[model samples]
Target: MKNEPLAYRMRPKTIDEVISQAHLVGPKAIIRRMVDTKRLSSMIFYGPPGIGKTSIAQAIAGSTQYKFRQLNAVTNTKKDMQLVVEEAKMSGQVILLLDEIHRLDKAKQDFLLPHLESGKIVLIGATTSNPYHAINPAIRSRTQIFELYPLEEDDIITALKRALADSENGLAEYNPEVSDEAIHHFAMASYGDVRSALNALELAVLSAEQNDDKRQVTLEDAKVCIQKNTFQHDKDGDQHYDVMSAFQKSIRGSDVDAALHYLARLIEAGDLPTIARRLLVISYEDIGLASPGAAARTLSAIEASERLGFPEARIPLSQAVIELCLSPKSNSAITAIDQALSDIRNGKAGLVPKHLKDGHYQGAKELGNAIGYKYPHNYENSYVEQQYLPDTLKNKQYYEPKLTSKSEQKFAEIYNNLKSNKK
Candidate 1:
């Protein structure tokens, strides 16, 4: 029993036996429709970890008359894929299920593309990443993509109850009774991962029996089991959102230490490299010129992460967070641009003045486009008097620099000089 994995022992054998995923099992659902009509398409299931993608694939095969073959993208090679294709050809109607399909490299993905397109095999690929981005477009185009959302709290509760009461593979022998409060606690902690909830329930039941309290599994028992097991991160769901929210808020609030802590959380949780890179873009877009170097430093960290990968790349991320938090905060430049755009959108479609229309000033003695545009680089103290703004907005000010540090002081001076010269 110790040698056997819990997932293997409790694997759902039939569509009726499976828990959660009612959206796919509901009346008139695609899977149900296919099962009824005896017609299944080459498709992909995209979802978070432990969300029943593989279980549903197996159930589909079990429910249908087609011969089923399983392949793991992590271990199966191009040769294995070809052999499967050949077998599928002989079998007439065969369903080939590929687990962790995103792990397959470009060459392996390309090798399967032709077979997928030709419908030599009914393919069911499962991934924890977004198939649109992770899968080869050619292969993905041939397969219908179905998104499996994380289990809701109520769905998780139902799954937990089913696992506890099922005689074949659950804790039926112990007849353990779990409280509603305890179930709620476990569901919340599971972060919408049914597998995690089941595992935790199984461990708690075992622990209760070990402690001579086999009649019931309480919140205390559940807590003990959770504490004993390593806190696993749910990368594609709730935990991911929770940690990222903390990270972004920490940066916005200028708490460098807290920001770094969240960064570490994401890295330790095995977040995708592209996702980490995207956070850098947020650093620039939201925390921009306020910290002039924040965007640049974040971009540099992104590049380093791409080159060096995790564990080692976290150092640059930490550095960027600290620098951003310490740097002066300002969004005036962004605000100015956004406000101008808003004005344009609000029907402020002011046309170009006759004097500045087209290239009318290209050869004019009044300096044309260059006229009224101050040459600050060629004036007293590198400053010049000019009327550069459109006449309608001649006195309007947009960017109001903050006096956070010496850099901002210089920016303020330049802004003032430009405004003074315009008068």
Candidate 2:
């Protein structure tokens, strides 16, 4: 029996079989039109790993019935490019799929540019990085870049079903009995990478102990093969920033479920420092005056996590996450500070009023420091409104407490009473 992996064997043989990327491969799509007319062009495929960049290129070549070749930008040299060009010169045309094109060196790129310009070799550059930021501008300008999104679970499940049933180039000959739980596990845990799903499925079917002369793939086997496929999230990459952004926004939006989901993802990856820093920031920036005690609570939780790190840290971290997510939120503290900062940065600052300046020292009285200062303890409610701000800034109010949260509402009432006392 041929021992090719299912991912390789299940490569889409036709455009119709290419899963996901409906915007590119669906009916009357631009790529579909290009293949149908055999009017191939130099293009770049950009997205996460294993979203079928190579498979789509292959499908396009198969549909067009054109000569196809593939090379890795990391391994292929200028000499290899020359060899492909030599062959294409005889064939009159060829479709070249260059994997990790972001890694294309200057020499290989310079050699390929002319061929791409002359239409002798249709270059399909695939990269996991953003081409605009990673690829040479000249090469990027020469090719139409199509971004392939990660495959959704539904798209991956459909592909898995096809692989399970196909008689040729699939496991139909072995008659594998894959449970629905196994299928769901594979579909969801692949983390939007169909290639990962197929490979794990194939491995589970081939490696499992056979029962009744048929391979049986269980949920445990699927998990063992792909190990939850929790997405290779780079802690310092764009995804990390995105997760942090979502985490904060979820808390602000009061979506406890989403907040907890992001919390678990971060915790699972052992990103405790960011989690620690982000939790404190959210408590102040989001919860703010709405829940004044939340900051202390969040800090207590973080301190607990610090005392016991990692696997145990997540418990206290989760506790803080749930409380913050469910808490009332306010931005008054941030608004007050930002407004004060804006004034200090601009020309709105002034000298402290004489009455508000230090008068405790003996000479301070001689400078008229406490000359007009009112002693509020003698008054009813023990509160008096005098010119606490500088003469120029007497009307400048920085802290405008909102009523969105209970603490802020209490502050509003106190402010109103103070204003009444002033009148």
List the RMSD of every prediction in angstroms. Answer: 9.3, 4.4
Candidate 1 similarity to native, TM-score: 0.62
Please report, in order, the local distance difference test score of every candidate based on alpha carbons: 0.74, 0.88
Q: After superposition, how far is residue 120 of candidate 1 from its true place, in Å?
A: 3.8
Per-residue error (Å), model 2, residue 242:
2.4
Candidate 2: tens digits of C-alpha lDDT, residues 264-325: 98987788899999999999998998999999999999999999998999889888988998
Point out where model 1 deviates above 4 Å. Answer: 1-4, 179-181, 210-215, 227-332, 335-423
Q: For model 1, how does the per-residue alpha-carbon lDDT over 51-167 read when each residue is reduced to its tens digit?
A: 788888888888886778889998988898888888877877778999988778888888887777777788999987777777887777788899887788898888788777877
Q: What is the alpha-carbon lDDT for the whole of candidate 2?
A: 0.88
